[model samples]
Target: MKATATMVLFPELQSENDTIASQLLLLPQNITKNPCENDRTCNKDSVNINVVWLDSTSHSHFYRSMPKTVQILRDIKESGSLNVFSYNLMQSLKGGTYVNTVAFTSGKIFSRSYLQSKKRGIGNLFNLFQNGGYHVSMIDDLCWTWSAANCACGIPTFMGVKTQSWISEVVLGKRVTIPELWGNFSKELKLRGLNDIGASLANCEIMKANGITDPFFTGKSKVAICYNGLYQTDYLMSSLELLQSQLNRANRPHFSYLDINLGHESTGRRIQTLDVSLAKFMSFLGRQNNTLTFMFGDHGNKYGTFVQKSKESKIEMAHPVLFVLASNDVATKLGRDWMRALDINQNRLVNILDLRQTVLSLAPNVDVESFPINAKYDNHPNGLFHPISRKRSCDSMGIAPEAGKCICYQGRVLQRVSNQTGVVVLANFALGELNNKIQEQFLAANGNESSGFGNCRYLIGSWITNVQQTVSQNITITEMDIHIPAGTGAPQSEDVFSVTIQVGSNIPALSTNIKLVHHERISTYAVYDDCRDVGVDGDLCVCSATPTLQSWHIDPPTIFGYISTVINLTRYLYIYERRTPHGLNLETSCDSADKTFEVVMRITSKVNVGYSKKYPLTFKVKHGTIFFIDVFYQLNPKLNWDVKYDVDFKQL
Candidate 1:
């Protein structure tokens, strides 16, 4: 017998229009007729094809009414090779209850509540799948949507699928074993093979090979299961279109199936429309002899919409969903029996747990008893009506079944709303701080006062003080005034002025040397009557009596000289007076007035090293009247550091 293959399509957020369009495209061009399609005998006698579609919007309904679905799947699995495909539409929706909770609470110091709630939901789903014996696969829509954003979490929705994969590895008998019936007595073991021979052969193979290939490789029978994480409407539409294209193409296999989760509320309504449209498309595909198809939502929405106020309220919003199946061969085999079994009029409640039973029952030569069955439904009143009726009893406000149109509890509703309110507040706070800093920096660098200077030059210098102060403290210096002298008439009316500005500790360093140049004035007249009538003797007179002189100061002066006296001192501060390579260098200058004044100042200014604390040093004027001074220094050792990583897999 040929092995059965299953293809599962997990639509994250699919709408009815999207599903219908997809179905139209997926419909097969040919059809074949066969009787007893639903009958177990007919299915087993002929080649069988089975497909399962699971959607998130129908999940609750499926779970509540799982017995019939399970029985049908079991029949398919038992009769022929089983092929299964599943999908989740909610995975594609922009936001889910758990996802929004994660987003809102992320990075918040007091937001464990949202995380805990999401974990709980995921944990419940995990438990449900693990208890069932279905092999699960997942494709996340969130990962696809934000592929360029580099989200920390790889995939966001259907985490239960990943957990189930892990569990399947442990529980599914993936190991080769010698049956107890083939038990080896000492004599039989010796007769079959020498123990050393088996061990030696294994050792030689291991030594020759790099590694063992995966034993689970199913070849062409590969089954892909996925869940749409947080997909947009357009994405869901495109995805369905892709699926339809694949199904219609003759070159590809016809037996593939799809499973999807249509999320709650709007997503659920959208999936329902998809189901109806896909049904028509499946009817077309049924024309093809080798094709089989099925689609359904996994669970229904508890709330009327995808967006909910709180996790607790969402719990109350759960509902049951619907499933549809189409297969030409299977329907003909069972004939009336198949119709009787699938009759929606019978009203059945089901859950995902029945999948194992359904698949096992469809496998060839497999006894139904061989697989475990926790529950089954066959027209039982309590079974069919109990869960659904109970769910419908509550209204939109989630009042108790007995409340029946009573005044809604405002407190309860408000509390739920409050739970999500914090997210908005925190987002606003972060944005506000970011805007404030941006505005402050813009004003300081480009305001009215600094505009006319063309470009304000930054003075870079460092000073080490024994005092320990917070970064908030402001540093100011009293000396070091650079001014344009009064009698120089040096463009005084132009907004240019000579003022002493102190370089603060917070100022960044510079790399190149700086020079200051002083231009002597020819006359002291503000502006001659005709503007150009000053003679040479008048210029001399301006230079002597008026002493139209100017001074310039350049610290760490390698390119420009610093002015010593304020006599007729019209000072101009010229930054970037010269350029040199990057590093720290010291310059010495001395002057005498019956005493030598020697200054040893560190010239540590970096063009690119903006505002750093690690490069702080002291500037001192020592040994007055010395022509030159010797200086010694070292690079800060704290600047160069490294970190290490250690891993111990054994502990794990």
Candidate 2:
């Protein structure tokens, strides 16, 4: 139930009024309060901290993909309304949204002790803001439903403050149709009459065709992270408008957390649509003389075709976008020294921990310029508001050697090692971890019954596919892919896993030096009839029942048609020609000697029913391994070659 200004409780909506009252009594007595009205004079001591968080956006991707957004941001920066700090702003941890957000909210790295304590609100920004006498609100258009701060998705809750307001798509507990949602949004637009920042309905018909009209229409409680839709952005736009109304009516200092999931949730697809809406939002903030706005990304796109394309993609994921826009009043109050520090620290090595400190420092009358000497996070003692050491590296910032690919570390001088023993050791370690995960999943599925993984057999590494290593400051980073053979009776397919590990200089010391940093199953698992949920990640499971393995040879025309259908290039007709069963394309990047077959194809554009010219294409397949076949074409001389089609052999 929504809490009102008078703290009235609706009997049907909630039963926790007494609990909320008791919690309010625990608040400190010295909560800051300025009797001055919400005007320019009130900004002398404090300003509302309005944070707009965009998930999974990297600085590089934001600049490259969202041209209009970048232009607006550039204009704001030139106008001295925004600060863009793109470089050296790394993620506090290597994990996904949850980990980075934890650091952002709590100002601490995630640990077992923190989880064990179960103190969700203590020492967090929510409590800090409340202590500063700010009316706190967390708003999200997708994936969050706040009921006493508990996330509906079973992740640990945020805030845990009962008085804080939650505005989310799932808050009402009843799913509405896309049209119904749009009607409500239209009514809200009429009420506010801020039509300049209207919804972006670009590609609306296409999105509808792809079943992406409603934010909550996925049949799940929350929208999936990888899902894409224009309505998601529209929902956020409407929600932000509603938040503006709330802020206007709020008398106390406000701390608003606007969790915008448009760009990142869709895996960096259709982010251009957010440019106009965000530009307007920034403009609105620019006019708010007493507001300090933070518009930043949690991290870059972690899982997508974009991230897997090149090494630069990985670097982009490490460097998230951070823009701190201080209103004119707040900027003047920060003084020249603080402004100078903000400028210098833009290029300094910073992360979510530092951002946490920065937010904490902004609390009313808090002067924690430096962290305690013995504090666990003492390495990076100050926030962006203070001067940061130029000599500080990832190590100095207490970033784990395996935490992430740090921009400060120049030791990623990769050298390919042939048949290294360390590769085998790390591969085996990763395989063991995968098997252990499978066992754990099985145990959990069966209500913690330790009767073993009933029908699932342990995966054994059949052969190593690829290995590459880099040594940076006595730390060795090894990336290897090993093909794990499916259990007997399962489909005749190999499950190739790409694993990354970090170790000390003593690579042979498998016990203490080795640490598995990242691992994922690259190949697809075709059969899981008996143990569907018992696999490491729902795909590595191999049922005990033996299925008939059928091998069929397709005609040339049939192969071409299959390729054409899967690629979805309606304007092209393909023709496949087999070179040889043992043919290997030595000129291509397919260096594996175990390649089973190679084929050449000629693709022709069909302007109408007639075929245009034929373009020769070649691809080599390593039988049952994970590989990407990229098809490129240049539509015009001035334009760069576009990757027209990509085929993942595992999916085939």
Q: What TM-scores do the predictions have?
A: 0.27, 0.60
Error of 1 at 33 (Å): 22
Q: Mind giving the per-residue lDDT tens digits that candidate 1 earns over 368-455?
A: 4543333221112221112222122122222221111111222222121221212121112222222223223333445523211111
Residue 176, candidate 1: how far off, in angstroms?
33
Top candidate, metric lDDT: 2
Clashes of 2: 0
Q: Per-residue lDDT tens digits of candidate 2, residues 1-652?
A: 1221212111222455632211100111122344666465663576778777777678877777677666776787788765544444654455345556666765656642244234343235565666666666555543222232212211113432221122244345556544654454434322321121211222233233345432321121123322133334444444454555445444456777766555543245656666766766666665565677777777676543444334565556667888777766777777888778878887777777777777777787555554342244443444777877777666665554555455566435767765434355455455555655665666566653233345665555566655667676667777666666655444345555567777654443222354567664443343344345532343456555532111111211221112222222111212222221111111112222233345454433311111111235455433221122222211122433321223222211
The lDDT per prediction is: 0.25, 0.49
Q: Among these predicted structures, which one has the highest TM-score?
A: 2
Name model 2 segments beyond 4 Å from true. Answer: 1-35, 38-43, 81-85, 111-123, 143-156, 159-230, 245-251, 263-267, 365-381, 411-425, 444-468, 480-498, 505-512, 517-652
